[model samples]
Target: MKEVKIESVFQVYEGILELPEDLQELMQKAIEARQKAYAPYSKFYVGVALLLDNNEVVLGSNQENASYPSGLCAERTAIYYAGAQYPKAKILKMAITAASQLRTTLEPIPPCGACRQSISEYEIRQKSPIEMYFMGERGKVVRSYSLSNLLPLIFDKSQL
Candidate 1:
């Protein structure tokens, strides 16, 4: 018999102002993008900003569809667009922000499981770590140094 333990590491920031200047800027952009999300059903808005090695920033907002599973998350939307537009660029960092129209979200909101899987694909493709920062409408922000930190047991092409 064997026992295995899995743990995820996250860095907590009291507020956005506590972050570095560049990260503060990225978080602001994420907030702006979040306003454009089309989450009429859930009333929860999410936005993501991707920073590429080429010094380009791509923004994405959650788009909801009438069919529940038809919609794509902000993480995937930004990553996919960045992939199509900057095929040669390596994504260096990503900032995610989410807010709910129904109530004030005062804690960090991490991406869903599906988002983690989708993001792993890009991280694997670029052969580099993607620093991720996520936060709610207000309050604390959380950071993951690498996608691996969030999904310890990543399912990559090796599984195929």
Candidate 2:
């Protein structure tokens, strides 16, 4: 039997300025969206912004429900909205940010497992990678990585 290997790449940045201006704008929108999160339960508000190839920006905020499992993440919310509103457009990139008790947290906001999987679907559907960005309360724009990098060995329709 032969062993298969998969690898991914990510680059940490001092801030969004290190990247393209468009990416910087996306991150800013994500941070602004954080203010609208409805996360009373966890106090961990997350915001997501998707940049469509058509030059549209979609925003999402974590919505919590009385029943924990019923709630959806910001990433999915934004992705779903983008899919519904701009069905034919490709999602070029996404930026996510989080806050707590009126202040941003120190740690970079990472997408949940389910978010990663959901994002993987778009990557496969679009036949292109979706670049993702995240930041911490310290205003450090930690890193950027492709969805494939985060969800390697993903189970797509190919498995069905």
- Candidate with maximal TM-score: 1
lDDT of 1 by residue, 1-160 (tens): 9999898878999999999999999999999999999999999999998889999999999999899789999999999999899999999999999999999999999889999998999989989999999999989999999998999899999999
Best by lDDT: 1
Judged by whole-model lDDT over C-alpha atoms, candidate 1 comes out at 0.94
Error of 1 at 123 (Å): 0.8
Q: RMSD in angstroms, all models? A: 0.8, 1.9
Q: How well does each candidate superpose onto the true structure, as a TM-score?
A: 0.97, 0.90
Superposed model 2: Cα runs more than 4 Å off = 1-3, 102-104
Query: In angstroms, what RMSD does candidate 1 have relative to the true structure?
Result: 0.8
Kindly list the per-residue Cα lDDT of model 2 for residues 1-160, writing each as its tens digit.
9999887777777777786798888888998888888888888888889989999999998899889888999999999999999999999989998878866587677789999999999988998888888876446665555787877778889899
106 in model 2: Cα distance from truth in Å?
2.0
Q: Candidate 2: worst 10 consecutive residues by lDDT?
A: 136-145
Distance from true position, residue 108, model 1, in Å?
A: 0.4
